[model samples]
Target: MDNDCMNNIEDRKIIYQLINFAIKHKKIMQNYLDETGVYQAQHRLLMEIFHNQNASQNHIVKSMDVSAATIAVSLKKLEKGGYIKKEMDEVDNRLNKITITEKGKKVVEQSKQIFDSVDGRVFEGFTEEEKLTLFLLLQKLNDNLNSMEDELKSKKERK
Candidate 1:
């Protein structure tokens, strides 16, 4: 059987392959996180704040696709580690704006290098066209999943 044809299998083998790849990818990502002295969610949280210092907890919750409680816990941990600081919004006392500390900036730099190396290694042999095609396919996969999730949520809310 042609390797390309294997992707067309309709017996759910593709799902299994995707699941296996996710597991392996998580392991590799964990190794990168191990060097950063931050947990997976914490690293993401830091990067989000680094990119958008004006981000509020609500914004983080939506952007990270994580529960509000998860963001709170991660924020608390990051604050304790001196990697981030949350200050009351000047315009709105009820909301807090997140900011990355100088220490967090250093962590971001190190984590960037590590992740860049990981990406380089992962796509070592791929040409530029292959990379674009892979990204496009992945985006389509994500769109399909998101649509399914929205449908499920709507159905659940109706019951």
Candidate 2:
């Protein structure tokens, strides 16, 4: 096989591995979330509110880059579960200010422990140097993907 063809095949194999890794990681996370009774979407929304206390739904939609309807649904579920409380904005009565409840704070702390445990297990056999090297490589890959996205946006804007 030619050099270019060989390179393309190697690239494909790397991408396939990356995709599989993401899927498996997501599955494991979902399973953990299920056992904790914290759906992924609700967990994310709860955490956002927990950190940003009194955040508006619109602000969360923008920060998360998700549709308002999607955020609304998740917020509703979170509120119903007593994980969050929504009050009308004092100045802007049309908007609801979201705040994480005490229960939500506990959940956030629990989630952190769960994530740390998962990371420990995932990197159990790796040495410190190996872990650092893997982190650096993953960061480089993330930066490349961000650059490509920016380039695509620039091209589209130019058109």
Candidate 3:
């Protein structure tokens, strides 16, 4: 095979591996998310709020890399479910500060235990050092991909 063709084939296999891994872990993650009655994407927002209470909706959407509409819809659903509260900023009413409700806190506290246990069990065979090394490698790969994405975007903008 030509070098380009070989690279294409390898890329496809890498994509397949990523999707397969996600499918395998979906069951483990979905069970916990379902029990909490939140979608996976919404859980990302919840986790963000758990760490950064009274966070601005715009900040959350930017950090989460989701569209404003998507974030708004999710926030509305969560608010209706009594998991979150959106309050107007004291100085700038244009910006909304989102806070996790007591109910949301309880959910996170319980779900965190489930998530931690699942993560531990998933890599039970790996030593602590192995886990750390794998994490660092994955982080490096993720950062490289992000940089490549930015480069592509810049090239497109120039064109």
Candidate 4:
């Protein structure tokens, strides 16, 4: 086969490996989250509220790039579970300010520990040098992908 064809095959293998890695990682995370009694979406929303205390629902919807309805549903679940509390905004009565409750803060801290442990396990067999090399390579790949996206957008705009 030609050199270009060989390169294409190698590229496909790399993409496949990346997809598998992502799937496996997700499964592991899901298993851990299950043990914590928090759904992945709720955990994500809780983390956002933890970091951005007193944020509005609309702000979370915008920041997360999700629909308001989706955020509202998660918020309702979280509030019912005592993970978060929604209070009427003092100045803006129309908007409710969302804040993480004490329970939610504990969950967030536990989630951090869980994530750290999982991350450590992920690189269990890798040396420090290998980890650093992988980080650099991934960074470069992300930069290249971003550049490609920008170029595509520019082309579309031109047309």
Candidate 5:
């Protein structure tokens, strides 16, 4: 059966396959994190700040699709690590902006290379077109998953 068709299957055998992929990939990423001396969420925040020094806490909260408290914890951890700094926005006392320090920028640069290598290794043997196809497919899968979240919430309300 085709891959997408399998996703519509009974007993969710396809869901189990997706879980295996997630588990295996999480293990791979955990290995990378262990070698890198920090967690993935911290790494992501640094990367985001590297690209946008003016990033706001609310922006990170929304982008990460996580709680503001969770982002605050990560932000505080990064701040304590000297990887980033938070400055209050001049226009709004309620809004704070994040910026990556020079050290943080260096770490981000190094992590980018590491992640690139990881991706290359993960997709090794796949042709460039195949890689693009996989990328598009995953993008669609992610969109579908996100769309289901609201449906799941509504079902829980009914329950």
Candidate 6:
């Protein structure tokens, strides 16, 4: 096979590995999230809010990469459970800003501990340099995906 074809085959294998890794990671995290009385999506959303207090619903929807409907459902559940509060944006009554409550902060702390432990488990044998390289490569891949999304959106707008 030509070198280019060989590289293509190797890249496909890498893609497959990445897909499998994501599936397994989700499954593992689900158990942890469940124990904390939140779904994986909710946990992620909570963490996002924890990082960005008083963020608008629209911002959360974009940052979480979840549908608006999904965000609504998750926010409702979180709010009902007293984990978060949704206050109307002072400048924009139409927009609701999400703020984590004291209860929600506790959850975030717990989740952070779980995540830190999980991270250790995932990278137990990896050296510091290997971990850094992996982080950089994943970031590059994420950037490429974002660019592809932007291009697709531009094309759609042009059409």
* Estimated TM-score for each candidate: 0.83, 0.87, 0.80, 0.88, 0.75, 0.77
| lDDT accuracy of residue 138 in candidate 5 | 79
Per-residue alpha-carbon lDDT of candidate 4 for residues 1-159, written as tens digits (9 for 90 to 100): 799977677777878988999999999998997876789999998999999999999999999999999999999999999999999999999999999988998999999999999999999999999999999998998999999999999999999
User: Model 1, range 1-159, lDDT digits (tens) per residue?
Assistant: 898787677747767877998898889988877888999889988999999887999998998899999899999999999999899999999999999999999999998998888889889999999999989988998899999999999999999
Q: Is candidate 2 or candidate 6 better by TM-score?
A: 2
Q: Tens digit of lDDT per residue, candidate 2, span 18-69?
A: 9999899999988887765779988887778888989999999999889999
Tens-digit lDDT string for candidate 3 (23-124): 989877887778887877777788899999989999998888999999999999899989999999999989999999998888788789888888888899
Candidate 2's C-alpha runs over 4 A off are: 1-9
Report how far off residue 6 is in candidate 5 (Å): 12
Local distance difference test, per candidate? Answer: 0.91, 0.89, 0.88, 0.93, 0.83, 0.91
Give the alpha carbon lDDT tens digit for every residue of 4-91 in model 6.
Answer: 9776686768789899999999889778868888777888899999999999999998987889999999999999999999999889
- On TM-score, the stronger of 3 and 4 is 4
Enumerate clash totals for all models, in the order shown. 0, 0, 0, 0, 0, 0
Quote the positional error of residue 48 for candidate 1 in Å. Answer: 1.0
Please say which candidate is ahead in TM-score: 1 or 3.
Answer: 1
Top model number, TM-score? 4
Clash pairs detected, candidate 4: none
Arrange candidates by TM-score, descending.
4, 2, 1, 3, 6, 5
Off by over 4 Å in 4: 1-9, 155-159
TM-score of model 3 vs. true structure:
0.80
Would you list the clashing residue pairs of candidate 2? Answer: none
Model 6 stretches astray by more than 4 angstroms: 1-9, 89-92, 139-159
Best-matching candidate per lDDT:
4
